[model samples]
Target: MTQTAQLYRMVMEDHVCPYGLKSKDLLERQGFAVDDNHLSSREETDAFKKEHGVDTTPQTFIDGQRIGGHDALKKHFGQDVREEGETTYRPIIAIFSVAALMALALAVGSLGTVLHIRVLEWFIAISMCFLAVQKLQDVESFSTMFLNYDLLARKWVPYGKIYPFGEALAGILMVGGILPFLSVPVALFIGTIGAISVFKAVYIDKRELKCACVGGESNVPLGFVSLTENLMMIVMGLWMGTKAFLL
Candidate 1:
């Protein structure tokens, strides 16, 4: 038998509460019969809020007991409740996941026998370019955030502004397997500086902050993600230098 639920939500002339709609959908999806009690007027909505001691609408009740709002309903159903200002690995995971697929596709399309090292190089380069593009989208915002913990950005203001472009240039050059002299140094120099800065901010100083690795508009925390990016650059840069020297 389907469980029954009552949802009290605001539905006014000007607007209908989206949360209310979502709640109704979620309950029904979970095999619940939802009684959607729409508060058609502001007065009704306000009165309902006052009666239940709730400041918001989209309230849910299950089995004659108040289950609060959408978030509460999710909790009751054993779902991960993600609130605002929460740290998540979604962004970095998405970026790298796509980058890996792209590298694999490129490797498969290659005519000659594709070296494993070359495939790895391509993956790192592509990932760098993708991340750099995100930062370049809002350089001013990225630079401001970068200044909070990046040692080079703090000392040389211009470095922050130039960072995205430099990263992109290095990645692009590396992808084309050209200008190793220029790209290798840029990768090494910036990667080293970034690694040191992240270590100081996160480990040494033990300060919590946002990472500008993706850009200023991102919510990625200043820690593992940032460290991994810098480390990848350092490894790739060193590899490029050694390969060039050996050739």
Candidate 2:
């Protein structure tokens, strides 16, 4: 059995009982079998609460660790449960960055095949580079907007500090189209960091999060598609980095 499954078995004693009925339902939904008879007694529950620092019903115990009540459970399940107003622009930035690169590639290929002159290649390359830089700037601006404390829609999240500054730096490099050898590492690092930030923000803060990307207001869930985009950018960045610097 899974840890959550075992935890459910250990915590619920009477499925029909008032004390753990809600918790039992939640556990069942999470693929745990509920057997209330095996649950701790009322006196035992009080002691368990005291011993584990739990003062609420529907409290979860994951391998003896008190993961908290309903809010905690939702969080564990990757549901939206955060305080209001925690904004994240990582997705928007990521999408734009990839799109800019693709545009740059297309511009280069067209110029090389049609014009045949190296000058056209340089011109298209420069333009694409400029566009990439603009996209990077947009990402920064969006991230700043989300981080703004003055915005009422901005949430107070203490967890964003854990991400490294390297992520933003790497994004800047990708936009600048610099150092081909380092593109993969840069994109991967930035995307991974951004992905974690986005997921955590969405999962903890249960609400339709505003997209920081261009046209992000279209009402779309920032799900696996966004994550895949970042990963693809990393690959593209890596390829570009290699071709630009090495070949």
Top-TM-score structure, candidate number: 1
In model 2, which regions exceed 4 Å deviation? 1-141, 144-178, 200-207, 215-221, 238-247
Q: What shift in Å separates residue 29 of candidate 2 from its native position after superposition?
A: 57
- Residue-by-residue lDDT tens digits, candidate 2, 1-247: 5434433223444443453555567778888664443345667666766766767555666555666666676777788764654554544456556654555565566554433333332332333333334334544444443342212223534312312233444544554556545545655664555555556566555444544323222233455444444455555555565667677
Worst 10 residues of 1 by lDDT: 110-119
Which candidate number maximizes lDDT?
1
Local distance difference test, candidate 2: 0.48
Write out the backbone clash pairs for model 1: none
Model 1 residue runs over 4 Å out of place are 10-18, 37-51, 111-115, 217-219, 242-246
- The per-residue C-alpha lDDT of model 1 at residue 200 equals 95
Estimate every model's Cα lDDT from 0 to 1.
0.91, 0.48
